[model samples]
Target: MGPRPEYPRPALRRAEWQSLNGEWEFGAGDEPVFDRRIVVPFCPESELSGIGRRAGDVVWYRRWFDAPEAERLHLHFGAVDYRATVWVNDVEVARHEGGHSPFTADVTAAARTAENVLVVRAEDPLSDKTIPRGKQHWTETPEGIFYTATTGVWQSVWLEPLPALHVTRLSLVPDLRAGAVDFEVDPGTDFVVTLDGEVVGRSSGQPRGRLRLERVEPWHPDSPRLYGLEARLGQDRVETYFGLRTVEARDGRFWLNGEPFIQRLVL
Candidate 1:
């Protein structure tokens, strides 16, 4: 019960943050020298990353932080496993290959100024025939029920400080029978949305609009209602949360909005 300090990406949010998990300075690599200590986003084969073994294809992680003179300086990685190469004080910004999703790099010209020396070089390749090693288990010992391989930063790693036209992206589209909620912004300004704080929806600097909503409250699963979004463009402002409900599959059964939906076989 350590790690997991929250704010791992609540649907793209930013307000200047910093959380490069705990101790990092691992070894085995192409220029590694930082002995041990690992606990970031856990995945040195789990056990909350206290060095739970099996990691060596080329791994190396180092850490150091404190630099925020922002004008841009983003470095986020909530997933990394197949190939990640990044450096900050040593220059070389970012390079990712995908172990699941998120990836970012703009280390604003190598972290503003002061103290910043972040390095990461992970290249898993336990082989799943070309790579996409999902169910893990690349065998070196285990036999029957497979599942063991996972290396380098399993998720979470942060730092964001932007201001040069922020709000990179957000595209939500929920149309519960046309109650509307369709936004597509990525530089397209003028935005406003709220539900628990009023102001249902509004958009003028359109990049694509539609935010109608009057009383609509769908989102099923025993009333899992959620609607509390706040978005602003320019200097960026995000706080996403949405749920409008809609699931479909026609005649051959399965539907949620057009009716006929049944599941619970053993809840």
Candidate 2:
């Protein structure tokens, strides 16, 4: 068997979603009141989050969503740093906390047709001195390369269908040599590709097909070009973006943007 590919970020997708990724309550020692706006997928410490102040180890995030007929529901978190506890409609529904990656919780039992309240509490020991602390700075006095810390919901929270018969994943591999992208849908299905609301490419009956597109814009620092795709399954549709580029070794050196250089890790 071949190596399984990495699942796309924001994987638990659905055509219908109430994005609770922006801002919400956040505080430690006491539950937060009122809401603050923060960008999903970016930590509070990041410029994207807007709420630049470092949150303490524990903070709560609360929001509401409405489901029409009360089908099984899935709660998705793009990436919540460290550990987190989740509640739905005032009822404890799920819990997860890790600074990297993503996770999902089945919340079918905790949802109502009207409005569902969600609460999340996150905690991290900053610098445990023992665990792999990544870029998290648990210090009140942030020093050195360490930046601020992000607690609570630092990612998008969305609802996905709890399908009775099917669940699938898709991966698009750009093959410049073939002048196309190898699109393979797990539990494979038909799909289409588009760009700027225009149908640029597509895959037919076969689950795995080549989606060819012209104007091969080599993704680079100077000229970055990307294509969009929308895959269909039953009544569900998903949007994805792909780039055409490659990395190769030349003259015992690494080249990026057709230039010989060493990548710098500022973090």
Candidate 3:
């Protein structure tokens, strides 16, 4: 089995997808002449990679897979430390920065039917403090609060097929006081909002609207009630969930679900 062989995105999920986590050709250079194998989703500095050594500033990863049948295909990376440049079938598809955020590239134009080569080049400077390093130590060894630095692709890589006019983005903003959630669908398409498998609201030729719940269930630490949210736009559908709660700090104590609660914060 491959490492971390699970759906990378849990908040928003689709039924059909493919996991790209497994062994891949790994090397350090500008070219794609890989010299070693590494377990992906795991950084080179970790033991799981089989190459428990620093990956310097630049590293390369190469792999191949058959393209799935769909109108459009998207290549998703949960994250790649620092900067990442992707090439599909030797055609540059995406270039992204920021080590902690996820990115995707539309590979429909560059992908082939039978098989395609995917190459990724990650550039993470070991000593660049200007970039967000978080808890990673800049030195070769760990010291004090700092720990071993992680470089290159350290999260799941996957692919999913979509229609040409599929839903691109969905934003949900929970309003605890109003007992509603304001939603906005990209491209301003007709949509239906469902809560816990029940249709709660519908938008006719409108994209932004509010979905009010008949019964307000304020999420608390003890109860922790969450409402399953499903938004459908034509043939595209996405499944997600949201909790309704509120927090305030004006009372000199923590407030959760409109009640005063003591807070213990740990880092």
Candidate 4:
């Protein structure tokens, strides 16, 4: 009902992720007041955050959650505008600069077993030309081409538990012409690739492998079919999915699935 409640990281996923979306204490100063309740992952400019007003240059947010039992705990933020400084249980954990990319911090040392306090300080000065503002506006009122600024966290924030030596990343490249998909995993461990509960391929203690599909069901706008993918390395496991599709341009024309493509507006 609320944005599907799914793990935001689709490419690399783990089952031990907890969503930090919902209510959080919000304030507009160097020190948090804890008087306002704003929804996480929604900027104050939006109505969903319960504070549908323009945000200050320096804003603060606070959240308290029960720490999950794990050997390692990682706090992930999909995105935060401009610059953000985070603290876990009064210990400075991370400071990230950039508004468009995701960042994570290992909070295993700062978090307590029962409960943990997370604080975020977001600073987005519109006058800072060096920082990328995207479509956010600078003037007091919104105008042409410039939209309302998204100052604070505009994406998902969550915590994930991980083992000591886990599969950190995966790169999947689909080859429609060859009817196979090449993959590479971090840590260079032997991994198995499964599609829709069936084993498609396996790696031999190497970081690379290929999965050959028996039938190629190309993904398109009409039929957005996808295959469930699972990869396991030792005791670490992750689930992801992939869709095979191709697009190219030739002779000053567009092509999809090796055929001529045309755009049709629904409106």
> So what's the TM-score on candidate 2?
0.70
lDDT of 3: 0.86
Ranking by TM-score: 3, 4, 2, 1
Overlapping backbone residue pairs in candidate 3 total 0
Per residue, candidate 1 scores C-alpha lDDT tens digits across 1-267 of: 347778888876666687888878788767777788888988787777887778677788888888676788788898988888888888888888878888898878767576688989888867546877656777644556667878778898988888878778888889888978888887777766666677777777777778788768788887887777666766678777778878988888888867788886872
Best by TM-score: 3
lDDT score for residue 66 of model 3:
90
The better candidate by lDDT, 1 or 2, is 1
- Candidate 3 clashes between residue pairs 3 or more apart in a chain or in different chains: none
Model 4 Cα RMSD, 1 decimal: 2.2
Q: What are the lDDT scores of the predictions, listed in order?
A: 0.79, 0.64, 0.86, 0.83
Highest lDDT scorer: 3
Candidate 1 steric clashes: 0
Point out the worst 10-residue segment of candidate 1 by lDDT.
Answer: 134-143
Worst 10 residues of 4 by lDDT: 191-200
Candidate 3 residue spans exceeding 4 A from truth: 190-196
Query: What tens-digit string does per-residue lDDT give for candidate 2 at 111-221?
Result: 888777777777766656664576656576667888565565555566666454333677778876566888778667666666556776767646676777754555775
Question: Which lDDT value does model 3 have at 163?
Answer: 79
Q: Where does model 1 exceed 4 Å of error?
A: 1-58, 61-70, 81-87, 90-118, 121-142, 153-165, 168-173, 182-202, 205-210, 213-245, 248-253, 256-267
TM-score of 4: 0.91
TM-score of each: 0.37, 0.70, 0.93, 0.91
lDDT of 4 at 225: 65
